[model samples]
Target: MDKQELGAFLRTRRERLRPEDVGLVSGARRRTPGLRREEIAVLAHISTEYYVRLEQGRAPRPSGDVLAGISAALLLTDAESEHLHLLAGTAPIQTGLHRRDVRPSILTLLERLTQTAGFVTSATFEVLAWNDLAAALMEDFGALAPADRNLARKVFLVSDGDGRGGPLYGISDRAEFRQTVVMRLRTTMARYPSDPAVIGLVEELRSGSAEFARLWERHDVQSVPMLTKTFRHPVVGDVTVDCDSLALTDRDQHLVLYSAPQGSRDAEALALLSVLGTEGIDMVPDARR
Candidate 1:
């Protein structure tokens, strides 16, 4: 690690902000350029002494995990975060838009899942592709801006369902769903530490949502397992489905499929949803007349 350069970089970034920028209070007579070393250490979940040693170029090189904590604490941009990793002798994050190409085979498979809610997403949870059933079951991914098509953005940026455009879980497992999504998201961010899209989404969420920031600070990381969620559809009432993910071996992408138990109300709802989609697809073109 370039300990001396790293020290200087940290000091400068820390000094550029005000106490209120990180939800800290400024008392009278308090004087620190941006945030004190102690405050940064606290935010990064590290020892004040250790952080001080690092800033003074007295500490050993930090691992990627330690750098990640510091990156989040400083609210570094994607480019800046990657620079931190490079200075610490860790691998830099990929500094560009997330790869969004879903394999043609995957698209065909998605189309064949008539009774399932199926969509394709990037490693960072950006919705790259989706089928009609998925569009019917959850929020419409196609309608959202390319950036807002991201699952993390939808979950964190949107408030509760009470708000006009807030996210609506429409199910009883809202907390579990959120916990799993956040855990998987943290894991994805680490896996692709330098991706500008992931870092941008995280920074945006951290700034706009205190709940997200709090959860993010905990540093929970995990894989998203096959689980079930219930969706309350306005036209079809409630539907419960098993959520499964199929990772595309060629790239950092996955196909998510949601299926309901046979003979169940959810299964019936899927059937109804398919019928609706079919009718829409079968409509005659206005210009053809």
Candidate 2:
């Protein structure tokens, strides 16, 4: 990543905020436009020299606590705080447990959501496990390769020839949507920098798509829980689905649910999903061809 640019951008953002923005009062005769380095250091409970070192890119690693302190002192946005942690190279701290081995109860919980399309995803956006409805709603989910089953990767790589992969639920503004996904992936990467899987996926995307690279450099972070999306299904035709993402508090896993909009034709299409399930049909293919 662009460490120098990150350092400079953070310093610039920190210097652009006024004391009043963070509920601090500034006395008269201050020469600078923003909080002074010493003042910020005091607020963050760090030495001026250390904070200076951080701004100068001399500090190799800063703890999450320190980064949080500085984030608060600077009144940073969520995206900015996440970016700060990434620049500090201390993000995505593991909790000393294998995320892949989360409680079996979660799997049971997913099975209970029969009417809705649901699945549990890892922090790196891998679809670790999914339910029947999820598989039927999105044909691509059924077609994901074992190694390339990632949301960000699918969004960028799964496309029709000539660079148009069709629309994500007939959404005309796909470029913005793609960028949003990239930003979220970048944020996740920042938090889990040591995850080789996550790193490798990013490197692959960078090499494959210039658009992804440009958006990654912007460093945007967002947590969108609920959205309405349309999908053009080969069998059912066009369907509008309401997608929701819920965080599993017990683990670093997220449960994603997809539902059809009430009173819409898609809702009728979803009803067919249960019939498919009852027939013992495995909608997801054993492999992507």
Candidate 3:
């Protein structure tokens, strides 16, 4: 949102990196703070004048390829690269819809994995579909609002003060999990800038959560395929699950599969969850699902 701050931050980051950091060499008598403008230009495959113009915020909007070059040249973090995309108004294409209506396939897959819990979520964090085991493992997902459904939103935007939502169901280490999710979201946004759903989600988070705003300013990006999560289930008690995220490239969605070590207490709890469905329970209402 702050274009001048964005440009300044990027320039400062570039000035803090040495030529050697980006696989460049600087001979003796190099008195500059970091790599010279010409050095960065060469590394980024751009003219020195153009690079200078970019630093000065005088150049025209850059293409994605050019931004990638600059990102590499400056060693920008995933969040930073995403921030760059936002600043340049060329964020990645994040498709918000799961048009395949693959609920049946998802249910079948979940049925096959009786010992594990799994669910399918769209790029914008819509819980398109989930198996019974998944529903049992995480009770809140079954009670999500169709419009504002997402784990990240629940963690960050939910306010306990207002009796809405909060990190009531997530792990105690909520900050780290929030950062991880936001970073992943940044990566998604970078790849799908035009997705109105993603854009709207970002807007909502920015308005609703100061922590999200702070993290978003950092421009971090992360795409880890796996994560270890601990949840404090209201009914089943505390359980630890290793979550694996598989990107369904064919469908432009992702499958978040949860598993626990066999023979562990958590595993037993998950096993019990497999037998239960959304019955004989009052689903918590989440206005911003």
Candidate 4:
């Protein structure tokens, strides 16, 4: 078990809960945030000392029953509960590097989506493959090396001259996208604790970006699906499109498609992107430099 991380996860979840949230009375002015440790232990039907040890990173691997009780007491969502299990070493963990190779059929599909900006991202958010439209809408992934194509890095590490994070192709949902990146990376790290690349990337982000460090400490595991997004394209102005992320479970990758309805203004913008293909505009900075 990752004792430190387990303790941290439990602590964060517990601290985010209020007494009223778990049906407990606020007997007095609480000193700390959320529900107290004693209350959590009481709700979980475990000893206060043991729960304290668990939160202190001094407890043994908790039994499934104990974990279930704690999960219920904390009122974790399904994703959060699964993350708790993963941190406590109670769930099945993927035991190797995350796959980067895209399925050939997926590559074919990207090519076939004539008007849509389609791309496939690895579990770590590396842009593995993309169509011409994707290259046009975003940056040209083909021009960069494998390491430079990670969306997480682009979102968190890359910044404008003022040191704030750069706009994600000037997407309207930049804030939500940052949250999604942290949530997904948290899940990825738990699943691939031993993978050097995963570990290094997370560490780099945490060290490089203060915003990333702040968000990482929250221990959030759930991500809301984004249905639509708008990008302030330098060439096409504002183009909004529907967002769809299809999981390629076999490879642990995602086929992300951005498209608009037929004959819509957004569709016309995408069509123009298909023809332009990063010709005159630099949507992204050169990562190689």
Name the top TM-score candidate. Answer: 4
RMSD of each: 9.6, 5.9, 5.4, 2.2
In candidate 3, what are the lDDT values of residues 1-289, reduced to their tens digit?
3345446656777777876887777679887677788887888898999888877877788888998998888888776777777767776443454343555666678678878878787766667777777777666465667764577777787787753337646565677767777776765665565677777888898889888888877655554444788877655668899888877776667788889999999998887666554441234344112
**Each model's TM-score, in the order given?**
0.63, 0.70, 0.73, 0.95
The residue ranges of model 4 lying beyond 4 angstroms of the native Cα positions read 280-289
**Weakest 10 consecutive residues of candidate 4 by summed lDDT:** 280-289
68-163 per-residue lDDT for model 2 (tens digits): 898888778786776776666566455233265546887787788777778877766677888777776654454557566666676676664658
What are the per-residue Cα lDDT tens digits for candidate 4 across 1-289? 8999999999999999988898888777888889989889999999999999999999999988999999999999999999999999999999989998888999898889998899999889999999999988887788899888998998889887667687778788888999999999999999999999999999999999999999999999999999999988878889999999999988889999999999999999998888878773664355223
Residue 256 CA displacement from its true place in model 2, Å: 0.7
lDDT of 1 at 52: 98
- Sort every candidate by TM-score, greatest first: 4, 3, 2, 1
Query: Candidate 1: TM-score?
Result: 0.63
Q: Which ten contiguous residues of candidate 2 have the minimum total lDDT?
A: 280-289
lDDT of 4: 0.90
lDDT of 1 at 211: 72
Clashes per prediction?
Answer: 1, 6, 17, 0
Clash pairs detected, candidate 1: 93-194
